[model samples]
Target: IFCSQYMSWTRNYGVQGTIFPAPNFNPVADAQMLAGALQGFGCDKDTLVAVLTQRSTAQRLTIAEAYQSVLGRDLIGDLREKLSDHFKDVMVGLMYPPPSYDAHELWHAMKGAGTEENCLIDILASRTNGEIFQMREAYYLQYGSNLQEDIYSETSGHFRDTLMNLVQGTREEGYTDPAMAAQDAMVLWEACQQKTGEHKTMLQMILCNKSYQQLWLVFQEFQNISGQDIVDAINECYDGYFQELLVAIVLCVRDKPAYFAYRLYSAIHDFGFHNKTVIRILIARSEIDLMTIRKRYKERYGKSLFHDIKNFASGHYEKALLAICAGDAEDY
Candidate 1:
């Protein structure tokens, strides 16, 4: 139902971004200002938001360095000390690099007895080969252990296999060729349509191995031949999380912004506040295409994401999120 409706829709992935590196950036000066803001009784949260949200992560890193060198204090540590509750989540999130933050999410996902398999699917399915590679590096560097090893131990069955393939970053790249695209489309059609029993091995190979650009072409070709969206067929054939995960991959390939828009919607409206989800999506996409996402969220949900956060949140947490959501929607 969902994937079919979005099949014809496409979003420009990199056309818009919300956050940018602050102009005339003086990390030392900003660091001193932040220190001053935090020194007194009630923190000047407005100044904190103004300085932190407007600056890019690299700028934040420099500010952290300056804060350390100048005040001989950890910037994130002080922010943690000064801020509490939901707001602190946002501010502390700003201190981490994207992949480093992603590694943190993965660690949390698999930390306890149970696991959030959907989190595994979200990161592995949506990210690029280079991004996956970088996240693996960052995960190892940050956590002092291998991501693949963790996934192997934490998850089982074909689901683990599916995630491992995405983590492997083995998708074929380069411009799409009509000949290969046609062949791949036929392979998928036969594997899903003509055949009966679970062909997940064949399915995973085709879905994970092809470039997204080529897969889009194959999805079109599959529709032309079968008169059915591949995602619809997958839904009919498979059930449960694996089906949902495959659909997510297709949705991401078709329109990544829409995929994330759906994610943001679920995170917000899914039975109270899933703060973890909110923090990850906002922080990771803030510097990327959060503007596009905000626009899409308004179009789809008929409300402002900023307004939703405002209504559902309060205190410094709300202030911090509003700072992130209120960013200029212009190219840097």
Candidate 2:
């Protein structure tokens, strides 16, 4: 949805990205500074956080290349040696291109004893068709496993079916038809009302097949006829990961940045950090729309994400998140 219309969408909405190509960015110079930060006894955590967090992913990759050329050492390897825990995770996550990072997260999410269903949902449900394709390609290249096959083995039932549909990355893009929206809305309302196991695939088909633009129209048409939000209906009709996956898709379609804002809020609101979720959202969206997510975070939660991070997180981890956050919405 976002990929196909990205050019037009950014033009219409204006990009609210937090990070960009650093001005006067000399990769060799930046690499030298990073080497200096990493070389000494204890490593300079402050310099590492400041330099890495502020640059775009593209810029960071260039710096990494320069680091290898200048010092004959791998930047990511050096970071792994020096940094530890969640702080190290965040720094390492920042170095990869977006597709590789997403692939890495997805691989780990499904790698161990149990699948991190939320990680799968967070990534697959929210990505555009092109993004999904890249991730699938990366997953194969890096892990030598098919993403869809891995997902199929890891999950089951209606939830598995839904993920399978999404993994195909075949959603219709851009164009919308209001007439179809009205028809699909009725179809969805009836399916929800039935709540029969029979209608599960039907629900998945409509939600997964339509363009995001068309789906938004369907949702509005749904509200007009049913007098309840589509999410509420899905909640009423479904249970478990199936319901959660559907809800994530709907929210992402409605407002991608706002959906991510809710994710950041949920991650930190539980008194301690859900470090993986927190790190994923901030790093993934840093170049795309973290600024707008910050704006929505304030609008939805009534406090700045930065403020919440400071309250729930401490030390270098907090600093890296804040640096990605750029600053509080209130400051702007």
Candidate 3:
């Protein structure tokens, strides 16, 4: 699912991740402490945060299993009763495996009356097809529902078609071709440049079908021939979620860390701070290129992501994020 591009990304930025499995861990001990924390009159929310956030997701999953075996209680269900809001979100997020967490978010986005279109766009537009496929499997296991079916029922028309194709989990992979890149660029140009009306399928096909390596080359060729970026052209012609999805694909292909940094920045800069989005990316990317994303955030926004988190978020939620924001890369 991932490519050598990500290795180059990690190398260029020197950002690996922020979290790892704790040394000399004891899941039974964790389960016991969690039981002790929850047994008191006033729940030890602080204890809950400490126990949950300090461990890796894999370790947390082990704790959940051991908690079940030792106390015969679901650690997550107990936490569900004990915590709320963003605090609960980050903690619960730590418990879910990455693919399942993504699946849960996708389910949340579509299960209710209205869709969180941005969440939908951010996830679908950003994930590799293999990640989406694993998420689909997790969604089915978690909810007994096919992701594609749910999406089909929840959405309609061109946007629906785009998402359906995206979820197919079959995109062009392997080597980048310079000659084919120029040809594909011309195809994309025709797709968006027609005077009568834009051919969205052409754009969707190119974005959904090509490998990121190939797409990067194609985007370079696209700018060379068109004299403007594809993103600018999309903004000039398209509207709403369609535009957002396409732009996300372009940003993701161009620089994934930058795309996430944009999301992180939006989550923080807006009124009231989009805490769910903030927590989602922060926790989700903690083990990936969050350090890279943080660097990009600073480069793009002229401020540190950690400084903004300290300023806007508080208590255990802030602490957990700050700890993860510590950078996965050793010596960051």
Where model 2 places Cα greater than 4 Å from the true spot, the runs are 1-13, 327-332
* Candidate 1 error regions (>4 Å): 1-14, 40-42, 193-198, 330-332
Per-residue lDDT over 1-332 for candidate 1, one digit per residue giving the tens place of the 0 to 100 score: 43222222323434455666666678889999999989966789888988888888889999999999999999999999998877777888899988898888898899866998767877888888888888999999998999999999998776777788889987888668888878877778887765444567677777888888889899999998889999999888777766777888899889887788888888889847678777788888887667778888889999888878877778777777777877654322
Tell me the whole-model lDDT of each prediction, alpha carbons only.
0.81, 0.89, 0.83
Query: Candidate 3 clashing pairs?
Result: 17-328, 18-327, 18-328
For candidate 1, which ten residues in a row score worst on lDDT? 2-11
Give lDDT tens digits, candidate 2, residues 44-109.
899999899877788899999999997899999999998999999999999989999999999999
- Over 261-313, each residue of candidate 3 has an lDDT whose tens digit, in order, gives 99988888875689878888888887777877888998999988988998999
> Where in model 3 is the C-alpha error above 4 Å?
1-15, 195-198, 328-332
Q: Judging by lDDT, tell me the better candidate of 1 and 2.
A: 2
The residue pairs that clash in candidate 2, if any, are none
Residue 186, model 2: Cα distance from true site in angstroms = 1.7
Question: Using Cα atoms with residue i matched to residue i, what is each candidate's TM-score against the true structure?
Answer: 0.89, 0.94, 0.91
lDDT of 1: 0.81
| Local lDDT at 81 for model 1 | 94
